[model samples]
Target chain A: AQSVAQPEDQVNVAEGNPLTVKCTYSVSGNPYLFWYVQYPNRGLQFLLKYITGDNLVKGSYGFEAEFNKSQTSFHLKKPSALVSDSALYFCAVRDLTSGNTPLVFGKGTRLSVIA
Target chain B: EAGVTQFPSHSVIEKGQTVTLRCDPISGHDNLYWYRRVMGKEIKFLLHFVKESKQDESGMPNNRFLAERTGGTYSTLKVQPAELEDSGVYFCASSNEWRTGELFFGEGSRLTVL
Candidate 1:
């Protein structure tokens, strides 16, 4: 089974400060990791994904994530936070070898950027 | 391009009643997926469809949950005798390329069973 764990239920950060939303995974085989964000009253929006490449992958809205194969972690990061960046973030993973198996998502982390 | 769209943005009903949710996938998209997010929980896969065929239905919870994509352009999920635990947000997604797995999602249909 492929699973993703996002330890923090909530993360608070000040505007202009760097922010990080942690995520870890467990999979029987290599995993495809992804990050998605949900704004108020909006659906889940794709942020970034890590398949197989340079550990660092950049995504939309100036967000990026580093894939650590050793620790089985793919943590989302941003250089600076903005008040509008506050939303619910979800980390998901799927076993690459599992064919069309669906993505397994974390419980999600709510981020609040205080201006 | 028009993204995936779901009908009945919100629905409130009594337990034991039936509810049907619909989704229209993007034009030219061959793959459509259904997912549900229970209150304060992770979004979970309910089923997947490739064209009009049921690609995978393993995630479907029970027999009461019925999904169909007759024309393959639009899909509908009908829950018979919906239970209180069935109340959740149902999200529909579509993708031409399921391999990369970057799915375009709909705003979701919020179901509330009292």
Candidate 2:
């Protein structure tokens, strides 16, 4: 069973400040990780993914994530936060067992950027 | 390119009634998927379709749920005798190919069963 976890239920940051949404995963095989953002009343938008590459992966909206294979963690980060960046963040994972298998998602974290 | 689209952005109905949700994947997409998120829960996979064929449906909850992609361009999911627990937001996604697991999602259909 592949599972992902977003340890924080909510993360608050001041605009222009750095932001981090932590994610960790457990998989039976090589991990396929992803990040998605959802605005109120809208569907989820893909942010980025980590298949097999350098530890750092860049994504949409000036966001990036660092994949720590040893730690089983892939944390999303941004150098500067914008008020408009406030939304719900989800972390997902997939593996070989996940042949066309649905992505296993985390409970989600609410990100609030204060101006 | 036009992204995945779902019909009936919102629906409200009474328990025991039936509801149908539709999804139109990208024009050239061969893989389509259905997902749902009940209140306070994470989004979950309901099923996956590859060109009018049922690729995998291990996530489907029960027989009350029926999904079809007859022409392989659009798909519909019908719920019979809807229950309160079935009230949730359903999302549809598609990908042009299987090698790239990146899925483009639609705005989703919000269903409320009272």
Real contacts retained, model 2: 0.51
For each model in turn, which proportion of the native inter-chain contacts is also found? Answer: 0.71, 0.51
Q: Which residue ranges in model 2 land beyond 4 Å of their true spot?
A: none
Candidate 1 Cα outliers beyond 4 Å, as residue runs: none
CAPRI-style docking class of model 2 based on DockQ? medium
The candidate that achieves the highest DockQ relative to the unseen native structure: 1
In the range B11-111, model 1's lDDT, one tens digit per residue, is 99999999999999999999999999999898999999999999999989999999999888899999998999999999999999888869889999999
TM-score of each: 0.98, 0.96
* iRMSD of all candidate structures: 0.8, 1.7
**TM-score, cand. 2:** 0.96
lDDT of 2 by residue, B15-91 (tens): 99999999999898999999998876778889989999999898889999999998899999999989999999999
Prediction 2: B-chain TM-score: 0.96
Model 1 Cα lDDT, one tens digit per residue, A47-111: 99999989999999999999999999999999999999999999999898978788888989999
- For A21-109, candidate 2 gives per-residue lDDT tens digits of 99999998888889999999887899999888699999999999999988999999999999999999999887855565567788889
